[model samples]
Target: MTIKAGDALPQTTFMIPGDSGPEPRTAEALFKGRTVALFSVPGAFTPTCSARHLPGFIEQAGALKAAGVDLIACTAVNDAFVMGAWSRAAGAEGITMLADGNGDFVRALGLEMDGSKFGLGMRGKRFSMLVEDGVVKILNVEEPGAFEVSSADYLLGQL
Candidate 1:
């Protein structure tokens, strides 16, 4: 089942690239005692994700922080290198780009989707969540091939 509001975020390590090198970050460490906005895309550098979804979040990072969000993160099924490169290309300096390399976190939240037909293999669905102190406040998941619910504008409205 899809994770819902009031659910504590799953404890899973995400491989992320830092200034020094790749590192592991846990969901508990990310969400504990903070209000966070996390959005996930099916894959890195995909059409909608590159042109609209990820850019929107990058542009609105300031506003989100102004609204009291402690962290704004973008995740994808790609590895740390890909995610880091994409973040740099998108000029997403303020947003944290997390690499769900093995899909452990996505699968734990029941958000994994099959994309073998596209030759992309398994991936995370387009989704966003608002978490406060480790508990989810809102979960927005987009329909397949749809961009309505998980957009930054939509999640901003929810906040």
Candidate 2:
């Protein structure tokens, strides 16, 4: 089932770009004791994701932190190298890039989307959630082809 408020996040491994190469980070390791503002895009560097979605989080990182968020993280079904490049290109200094390279995380959350029509394969839907101590406090999932609910500004308002 799709994860929702009050649900604990599924255990999964995400790749983060490390100095040497992609490094594995488990969901438990990342969220066990932290309040995290996490967002997911269909893919890294895609139009809406690149121009707006990811940037919104980057722009609101400080506000989110001030609102009791310990970390701001972005995830996509892309590899760590691509996520790292996108982060650097977008000047996302404070946002953590979590790479769901094989779609394990999203699949486990039941948030995977089919993007074959756009030449993209299985990908995560656009969504954001407030997770504290590995439990979801809020979840905002966007409609297909829509960007209204999952923006950082919207999430900030909810906070």
Candidate 3:
């Protein structure tokens, strides 16, 4: 089922590029007692993802914190290495880059998209959510080929 307001996030393991290598992190731990703004994309380094989605969140990250967001993160179906490279390439310092390499999180949320036609396999749909204490407070899922509702500006407006 698509996640909605008031639902606790599914317990799933996600990864980030750690100093030594990829490190595991869980949703429950990530959202415990904090407000998180997490946005997901189909893949890292894609055109819109690199130029628009990622940059928007990075640019607005401080403003989001000022608005009470404890953490801002971006997720993709790629691996931790790629996520780290993309973050470095984009200069996305404050935003955490999460790797859902196996698509477990997106599959659990029923937001996986088949991108085989583009030579990309299963991927997460573009979406963003306000998660507080592991429960969703708001969600903005983008329509196919759309970037409207899930953008940082839109989420800021909601906040």
Candidate 4:
């Protein structure tokens, strides 16, 4: 089912590009006892994702932290290497990059989208949420081909 307010996030593993290499991080490890501002993009380095979606979070990360968020995280269906590269290329210092390389996390939340029309395969939908202690407090899922409610500004406003 699509994860909603009050729903506990599903158990899944995400890859993070560690100092040595890709490291596995469990959902519980990331969310437990933390107020996380989590956002997902269709893929890393895509037009809108690179230009706006990710940058918006990177730009407003401090404001989010000031608003009581403990962590700012970004996720995508891309692998850890891509996520790491994107983080570096965008200078996303404060954001945690969570790599759902196989779309397992998004699929568990019923948020996967078909991107085959653009030569891309299945991918995660563009969305953002406030997760507190592993439960969802707020969710903003963008409509197909739209980038409205899922922006960092919108989430900050909600906070």
Candidate 5:
């Protein structure tokens, strides 16, 4: 089942790459005390994700923060190296790129999507959530091939 509003985020560790090296950060640690706007993409550098999903969040990071969000993040079912490279290429300075390597975090939240037919293996569906202090406040999950709700503009209106 998809996670719903009011559910506490799953406790899962993400393999995130920092300037130093790969580091582990738990879901609780990332959202426990912050009002966060987090969006997940199927894969980094994919057409829709690169052209729209991530760039929207990066462009609106300042507005999101101005609306009281503490942090804005982009999560992908990819390794830290790929995520790091994508972040740099996308000019995502205000957004933190999180690597859900091994899909542990995505599976824990019941958001994993099978994409083997597309040669992508398992990946995350396009979605965004507003989380405050460890509890989900709003969740916008996009239907396959659709892009109406999960965009940053929609989330900004929700806030």
Candidate 6:
């Protein structure tokens, strides 16, 4: 089932390109004690994700932070290498790019969507959540091909 407002975020390992290489971090470690703005895209570098999803968060990182978001993070069903590259290419230094390489995290949250028809295989659905100190305070899950509720501006308005 999809995680909703008031659900504790599931603990799952997400890969991050560390200085030494890819590193494993549990969701609890990232969200605990922080007001996090976590957004997930179907895939990194895809047309909609590249052109809109990632850029919207990157462009409004400052505003998001000012609205009391301790950290802004972007997650995708891509590997660490791809996520790191996409972050760099998109000028997303202000946001934490997480690699959910195995689709474990999305599945754990029950947000996985079939993208096989598009040659993309399984992927995360477009969504965003406000997680405060490890618990979800708000969730905006978009319909297929929709971006309205999951946008940074819309989430910021919620805060």
**Shift in Å, residue 136, candidate 5:** 0.5
lDDT of each: 0.90, 0.95, 0.93, 0.96, 0.90, 0.93
Error of 4 at 72 (Å): 0.4
Residues 1-159 of candidate 6 have per-residue lDDT tens digits of: 888899999999999977777899999899999999999999999998999888999889999999999999999999999999898899998889889999999999999999999999999999999999999999999999998999999999999
RMSD of 5: 0.8
- Largest lDDT belongs to which candidate? 4
Per-prediction TM-score: 0.97, 0.98, 0.98, 0.99, 0.97, 0.98
Candidate 5 vs candidate 6: which has greater TM-score?
6
RMSD in angstroms between candidate 3 and the native structure over all alpha carbons = 0.7
lDDT of 3 at 67: 99
Clashing pairs in 2: none
Q: Which stretches of candidate 1 lie over 4 Å from their true place?
A: none
Could you tell me which residue pairs clash in candidate 4? none
Ten contiguous residues minimizing lDDT sum, candidate 3: 1-10
Candidate 2, which ten residues in sequence have the lowest lDDT sum? 54-63
Model 2 global lDDT (CA atoms, 0 to 1)? 0.95
lDDT of 1 by residue, 53-135 (tens): 99889888878888889999999999999999998888888888889999988998999999999999999999998989999
For residues 1-159, could you state the per-residue lDDT of candidate 5 as single tens digits? 779999999988887778987788888889999999999999999999999988899888889999999999889999998998998899997888889989987888899999999999999989999999989999999988788799999999999
TM-score computed on alpha carbons, candidate 1: 0.97
Residue 115's lDDT within candidate 5 is 90
Q: lDDT (0-100) at residue 112 of candidate 3? A: 92
